[model samples]
Target: MSQLDTPRLPENASDLRSLYRAAEARAARLRVLVEAGQVLAGATPETLDAAVCEVARAAAHLAGYESGRVVEDRPGEAGDDNGLIFPLTSPGSDVTSPGALVLEGRRSAPSAEDREAVAVVCQLIGASLSARAREARLARLLGELLRGQEIERSRIAHELHDGVAQNAAALMRRLELASDGDPADLAKARDQARALVRELRRVIAGMRPPVLDDLGLVPALQHLAAEARASGMAIALEIAPDPGHRPPPAIETALFRIAQEALNNARAHAGPDVHVTLRLAYGAGRWRLSVRDDGCGFDPDAGRAAHDAGGLGLAYMRERIELLDGCLTITSAPGAGCSLLAEVPAA
Candidate 1:
């Protein structure tokens, strides 16, 4: 038969609808196979081709091939393998006949239509696979970066709490021991010592708020408000009683960082006299943090576009919230204001 006469493959609307059914069935089977292969891949953590094989078998089934198998081109199979094979069943028969329906283009002849279809399918599948791979890689990289940042912060916090703080206390004791001096000088020395202690505390708080570890999220948030007030920032923080509930550490951290970043953005870019508000509410077995600022707001979409060129603060905040299976919404308009809402399930 000619190339256009290659059995037509049922072109009627009813037949095409059935193709959807077939496609759904094929997708279900492929999902099962791929999921199973993923379990195996997780267990062994070394065999990628096997997982690809499992997925290919499903593709073959959907394409009406009788049987399919993945084969390697290498003699000893030391590297990646060749194309897939899907044997065809003879016409007017459900049973797969031997040595039929060959789709091996790299090693054998494949029809032009089949080749085009396969190329499109592979292109789509490849795009999906590449996206997934990139997500995994980015996750790993971000995890490493966060871990390193945490370590560095912890080190800096320790130095401030131990070395710098201790030296400030010693200076205070020495000031007390000094012979009589000008009252103004003594007053200035006392104020300078107190300022030094306050600066150290602020640094430690930034590294990791002590209340977060000791008191819980509420007190931690209160500390944030207190520090903001200390810095002359107009911050209004309101927290409903926890209702005797807590969130996972990761969720709490995510929310805290969201708040911190939002506040920082407001302070840095929103200009002075900016109004900041934070609210925490509980419902539907979840807790949400909402931050609003009446600053010189810009478009959220524009901010995202700007972020694509290496400005990662907002993106990082969104990533953290999403990693905890949460949703982040950013609403803003030029000269209107900015509002960020993040929700995470409570523990």
Candidate 2:
């Protein structure tokens, strides 16, 4: 073989041995990371926690520690004094995560490579934990949606029993008493029939707005703005240029409902004379809807907590968007205005 193609060797036996040992150590570190990655990547919901623990165990063994324990990040709580704590970092965020991996004992300080391996393992764990938390939150929101549906049904039942049903019964009694052809009784029954029609129309609109099906989303929103304007509210509606293709029924319904609810909330909680703006924008393969009210705002954290305790607030909105692989965000403070934004992919 040519000299350039020949393999080179260390001049001394000790140097050769050292080189061999260094290569072996590098390979061992890489092998541990690979194995840990496999465990994490293939972990199912049932095996997630166990897989995380296994990764910790393997990392501890590689770090020259007897064992390791997970220490949750809590105020005024300290981890083991005798161990080295490696903070778990989230893949999405720069902050130190909720928990850390603490290697139990250090007869000698772990090498740089060992520390790096542990750090990487912690990142993997952080990402997995975040995903698990999101899954749990989504499940809770779904349960809330079901409960909200029941509550809505109860409200509709009450309206029917007290308003429509009661009015109908009174109209029937008036007609029966008017069998004598009395003009006053007949006129009263006619007025009652008209009133009943209006109430029925209101109920039907609440269930599903006719304008939405007949005129489409843009016109429906324009109708909404006109209604608000007639009620003496300063509101502006803006629609971005459309691609001329209507969104799927579910998307249209969701966006309209969200906008309606947001406007209602603004009217109820926002102080008098608060200006509101509603906008819809379209982008490549996605659409965005935003409602902003320059009114008295409230703590979003408190609102979210209230929903978690079953208040059916922004959490329900988020659940609706998330179901369509979308995102919903609410920004507000005690003095600042409230802005509710939702983005969904085109179907």
Candidate 2 per-residue lDDT, tens place, 132-186, comes to 7777776887787887788669878999999999999999999999999999999
Poorly placed runs, candidate 2 (over 4 Å): 1-55, 66-131, 227-233, 303-311
TM-score of each: 0.54, 0.68
- Runs of candidate 1 with Cα error greater than 4 angstroms are 1-195, 305-312
* Tens-digit lDDT string for candidate 1 (297-330): 8777766644223223676777677667788998
Clashing pairs in 1: 88-101
lDDT per prediction? 0.63, 0.82
Clash count for each candidate, listed in order shown:
1, 0
TM-score of 1: 0.54
Global local distance difference test of model 1 = 0.63
Looking at candidate 2, the ten consecutive residues that score lowest on lDDT are 303-312
